[model samples]
Target: MEVIAIQKSTLEGMKNELKELLELTENATQKYAPIFKEEKWLDNQEVCLMMNITKRTLQTYKDKGLLPYSRLNRKNYYKLSDVQALLKAGQPYKSNEDGVIDQ
Candidate 1:
């Protein structure tokens, strides 16, 4: 009976661990807080993440005329509309919403 109790406790602990892991994953997957997908355009950081590039790379794209962007008070920005257009140009993307590349 003691052995059975120990096994049961171990199983419960593992279950709790699994639950925590799942919660962590869920939170990570929801890392992005979409506050402007419906009402406003996207910013530089959002476009950078969407294209899997950095802010400097974004500036390069802007300079190359490959991507449209703007600057306000020294802060650069990219519009969601522009991102959609770039996608049409075959810029390549992982996924539209999730930003996950296909493996």
Candidate 2:
């Protein structure tokens, strides 16, 4: 049996490098995670892309009052928080007049 001896200083240096790498990995994961907790406004195009729905469906949702939105001029904006909340509700759309899901 042969033992390849590693020096103490080299071991200490490796340990420090490992620690720094771990910290960097953690920071990167936090910065680029799949889910974002912060609330922000989304435009119609952004909302469509995120929800995987068509633009017409988005308008239908707005008209049916399923998704809450804000209008300025001809453009509409929705809150990311509200959309996430509705998704989390997991309820069927109960529409007397095409009812939107409960949020």
Candidate 3:
């Protein structure tokens, strides 16, 4: 291995700069900490129950791009915020010939 030497003053300056950079990063992280809070996730069953919809309907929503989800371990997970936003959007349902609302 080749031996390289850095001046003591240069090393000290590098350390100081690194320390300052770390402090700035930490401060920025803390400043926006609330925005990065852990997101609440809901599984398929929970989402269906909360939205009062069937699993097939939930699948339909996903297919229609009305709701976004992540699948892991062969299970689907959804963001609570996205579900709430869909609810707030008040997506209308279709009516059947018998005057029954079809969701």
Candidate 4:
């Protein structure tokens, strides 16, 4: 094997550059942390519990195009925003005075 050597100054410069890049990446992540937090995804059970419905009912919603979802690996996921929008719209179901969904 042949041996290759890098100058001490060059090695130091590379280290400094790598450190700066790490710092920049960290700052960017922190700055946009809240935005990522807002876009939460919920699974089938969670959505059903939140909406006070059953799996079949949730499937009906998907069938009727009232709710949107994403399917991955034979499992489904729903966006918190879309669910909130559906609740606000009160199309297929309505909530009574006690906040119970009325079908």
Candidate 5:
């Protein structure tokens, strides 16, 4: 392991930097927590597991506009509330005996 020394002058600067970093983190947490706390977004695997469906079936739902999602960085995210609403509303996607909807 390598050890580094900070002078007294640098110590105060480092403390100030740390404080600013923490403040920025706090501000971000305060701003973003509530926006996302209520509704969590699920990825493809999560959605499939939650709905007891396969990835292809999930894709079929997306294709048919039965499921809603937002794409970010080429990844799809589905809102928890939307998924719950779909389950509560009824079968969002039709499935055969194998539990996979025929596309």
Candidate 6:
């Protein structure tokens, strides 16, 4: 009877430990699910559409070192954030309400 009681207690302890481990794994997945979302790189054609410019003009910026991009497997790919930064930098702002004075 004593040995049986000890074996039962040991089994209960292992069950409790496994339950705790499963709960911890569930919590971690809930916390980091978004971080694992798929990311698709935007290409030059898509970037030109987003930036509202002609392909020739965008190519000029790429050649001039004003924009940063990556060439992947013989094709150009731009991070959307980096493209947004380039567009923001190139935007013509009406400084002092003078309306796009070429300073």
Top of the candidates by TM-score: 5
Return the lDDT, model 3, position 33. 72
Q: CA lDDT of 89 in candidate 4?
A: 83
lDDT of 5 by residue, 9-52 (tens): 99999899999999999999999889678889999999888887
C-alpha positional error of residue 71 in candidate 6 after TM-score superposition, expressed in Å: 0.9
Native-referenced Cα lDDT, model 3: 0.82
Tell me the spans in candidate 4 whose CA falls farther than 4 Å from its real position: 1-38, 91-103
| Model 4: lDDT to the true structure | 0.85
| Residue-level error in angstroms, candidate 3, position 23 | 26
What lDDT tens digits, residue by residue, belong to model 4 across residues 1-103? 9998999999999999999999999999999888658899899999988887767778778988999998869999899999999978875864455656557
Q: Considering summed lDDT, which 10 consecutive residues are worst modelled in model 2? A: 91-100
lDDT of predicted model 5 = 0.85
lDDT (0-100) at residue 37 of candidate 1? 45
Tell me the TM-score of model 6.
0.48
Give the per-residue lDDT of model 3 (tens digit) for 1-103. 8998999999999999999999999999998677447678899999878877767677778888999998769988898999999889975453355645586
What is candidate 6's lDDT per residue for 1-103, written digit by digit as tens? 3544468789999999999999999999998676445445689899878876666656766777766778858998877777788777873321233332232
**TM-scores of all models?**
0.45, 0.48, 0.55, 0.54, 0.64, 0.48
Report residue 91 deviation for candidate 1 (angstroms): 1.8
TM-score of candidate 2 relative to the true fold: 0.48
Kindly list the per-residue Cα lDDT of model 2 for residues 20-87, writing each as its tens digit: 99999999889856443455778999987776566666776777888999876989888888778766
lDDT-wise, the better of 2 and 6 is: 2
